[model samples]
Target: MHFTSVQCVQGENFLFLVNNADDESSFTYEEKSGKGPRSWGEINPHWQACKNGTLQSPIDLLDQRVQVLSHLGRLNRDYKPAPATVKNRGHDITVMWKGEAGEIKINGTEYKLLQCHWHSPSEHTINGTRYELELHLVHKCSQGNLAVVSIVYKYGRPDRMLSKVRRQICGIDEQLFHHIKSVDPKQDKELGIVNPGDIKFGSSRKYYRYLGSLTVPPCTEGVIWTIVQKVRTVSKEQVRALREAVHDGFEANARPIQPLDGRPVYQYP
Candidate 1:
């Protein structure tokens, strides 16, 4: 249903060009000037959802407010070790799955794994305290529905998955800046084969669920947010490597916490 123009074709590589010159999707995380989240509505009139949307994300998870629901069914995550590439998207480092590799089932709808990204200082906070990092595993169903699982990371031991990604990123001195830099492990590359399940969730499978929008622009509001309660640990060196991977002057790429605005947050046991 959706078609994109092939901008560049070289041997077997094809590049699809997306026209987002006038949208907030082109904006950065700078909070002071007109290019920030606060001015997204005025800058890009088309993506007014960024400012006016009620169900926005990166909310402060207040435990006293959530309703504990033990009857909610468990989410099925069928992720396999797949070939992936890492991209420095100006704001964050993202690991993208190559092809039809894995899928996750939520509420009976199966959403396939697309890509995973991180936010330094974390996007979601627990009771007003932010973690060292947050990893978002994004999935999409064939019907265009999105379901994101949020993993919180603290500083302690080295994380295997993160260490692998950090090793590849540590060598690159230049910033891609709106471009994707590939990491091919098969060719003895930087990134390694990472199973989605390898991401630590600690001892609890419990989480806080809510209906919310994307943290960034074009902030579509149908996204199902699954915020894990357990926190994992990663080494200080790993965190340092990730910080170095960011574009200049944009060290912290996390969006500010949004107001919950009376939305019901459920705790699934």
Candidate 2:
């Protein structure tokens, strides 16, 4: 779906949301394919921001460029358990909450938790180093503005959240393997009641904040990105399972890091 900016309730700015599921066949991570990241904007008129937008996401969080401030405050979240479903989106595995799980308050504006997804080898980097995995907790405000909370992971212990839904993911993978052409791409496996809080953010109260765009098409900009500073642990098996669950070309689903383009990256105290 095409996304366009609209005035927010505050009236000081405009924001938009990426509200539709992307057609996985239309794009891919394989650079050999003409539908790779470099050609996303050219492939669709609505995704022009993928190539031309200044404030893009998954930027390398360089220490020298980050401005630390106590005023930004700790990452505020109030997520809860809700009826959810797990889906293999061809490109990645996503856990979608069926109801209002909870909301996170940012700068006095509330963004309700919508869904969370995984990206392997991380999209965002720290000090030029990419980790084993990354989880994006996506939120949206009443105005349709988006905010994402990201937690990067290194191989160690299995993630609590992933472990809870691994079986569902594996089942989907198995079904797709046996019936690749017949399995519905939009099918979702019921996850009963899953808690977003189970996805730990480590112990670090600090996080990096910036304005960016959706890593996927239509690559809409104006998204608020919050990347937690502490890199959590996940088992190698878990990471491998996530990679294997998606389509072959999407084994490594991370988008290439985008340039910061002079946008400010803030570290909260």
Query: Over the stretch 116-178, how does candidate 2's per-residue lDDT look in tens digits?
Result: 988998999999999999999998888777888999999998788877675444444442323
Cα RMSD to native, each candidate? 8.3, 4.9
Candidate 1: worst 10 consecutive residues by lDDT? 11-20
Estimate candidate 2's alpha-carbon lDDT, on a 0 to 1 scale: 0.78
Q: Against the true structure, whose TM-score is highest?
A: 2
- Cα lDDT tens digits for candidate 1, 1-269: 10011111121100111111233235767766557778766676766877898888889999887888776656567888777667655556678777665987776668788888878879999888899989988877665567789988899887767755544555454433212234321222335466766777766687888877778766666677889888888776666656665562336777888888888888878
Point out the worst 10-residue segment of candidate 2 by lDDT: 1-10
lDDT of 1 at 119: 81
Q: Which pairs of residues collide in candidate 2?
A: none
Which lDDT values do the candidates have, in the order given? Answer: 0.68, 0.78
- TM-scores of the models, in the given order? 0.81, 0.88
